[model samples]
Target: MLTTKLGVLLSGRGVVAGDRVRDALADAGLTMRSAFTLTQLAAGPVNQQTLIDLLGVDPSAVVTVLNELEGRGLVSRQRDPADRRRHIVVMTADGTRTLHTVEEVLDKTDDDLFAALTPRERDQLERLLTKVADADSCAEKY
Candidate 1:
């Protein structure tokens, strides 16, 4: 009880959240990070450097992820024609279809995770968390 209150109050990392989320995503053969990477590419080709910055992951880690996605035919990395130096990551057609499928599964999984909370309470928590995240953005602006 106290821990749940404190989690909402402090907006700290939910230590077990990742494991649960991973389990939730496993049905789609996706990891949390892999799913996130797909969403990022859904916007369009992401430059390697931009991906590193946006995802806040190490360059080597990004490379490994890109390699894995490429092997799965979920994404492809091609050199930027305009900038020759950076590689742009783009999602494949299969990746798009898979992304939607995973999204549906993840939605259900998210509901399952939050099943302990009433729907109204879930909305309230989401609002509070959004406020906290917005505050974080405001803090970063300075």
Candidate 2:
């Protein structure tokens, strides 16, 4: 069957897992994209273009996400001092708390999703996935 193909199986599982994680994030009033953005901003402030690069999404898409986060008081954007045209993005205190909450949500979701796998198997899967991801030239775009 087509599902037996490695690529097909991997794609199917990836979609399902991504959906599950997105659902969990939604319950916390965040999108997967927004959560990822918050995680990046948690480290330090970065300009909008940097987010556009890191997210591997269109500049408009990054603006939309930033708009959403700003509306929610989860992030703020101010003009970059070095570049008047660039806007620096930073996570708010609420954003930091929300990021922590989503991290816990993701941890729980991962546990549930991989319950069928043993601890060793889970570790192996992570390593294998990382290896495959690292090998992908497309991944370098992000």
Candidate 3:
């Protein structure tokens, strides 16, 4: 189906975009793992388990990435005041700086990738993608 092909193509584009952003971040002395973890933290302080769930990564993988980030002094983990059993992950000032750099990289990647599309086409694509994402989220509630 054409729609299916489009979907696959979009996924491939996403992978390419991610790779480009990763490389840019790496050149800036930031790892893809740390950038991703900090992006999660940017939403707010969250537990390791929640980050694992959101990223769809294994617990061990999440732990390893978090540990590396901690070692880099980009992230800090602390016991949740409300629940000592849970660890809250927060980004440090260094992490925030890295996130800003990552954001710039992602912006450039998006601009380059979508440059082929006209402004109207880009607007339509964004609207359609937003609708699909919203639908998926709504479906999850059922």
Models 1 onward score TM values of: 0.79, 0.89, 0.73
Query: Candidate 2's residue-wise lDDT over 1-142, tens digit each?
Result: 9979999999998898989998999999998778888988988899988889888878887898899999999999999988899899999999999999999999999999999999999999999999998799687432
Q: Name the lDDT of candidate 3.
A: 0.80
For model 1 the TM-score comes to 0.79
**RMSD (Å) per prediction:** 4.1, 2.0, 4.3
Candidate 2 — worst ten consecutive residues by lDDT sum?
A: 133-142
Off by over 4 Å in 1: 1-5, 8-17, 116-120, 134-142
Please give the lDDT score for candidate 1.
Answer: 0.80
**Model 2 stretches astray by more than 4 angstroms:** 139-142
Best by lDDT: 2
Instruction: Mark the 10 consecutive residues where model 3 has the least summed lDDT.
Output: 133-142
Error of 3 at 23 (Å): 1.7
Q: Superposing every Cα of model 3 onto the true structure, what RMSD results?
A: 4.3
Ranking by lDDT: 2, 3, 1
Q: After superposition, how far is residue 104 of candidate 2 from its true place, in Å?
A: 0.5
**Best model per TM-score:** 2
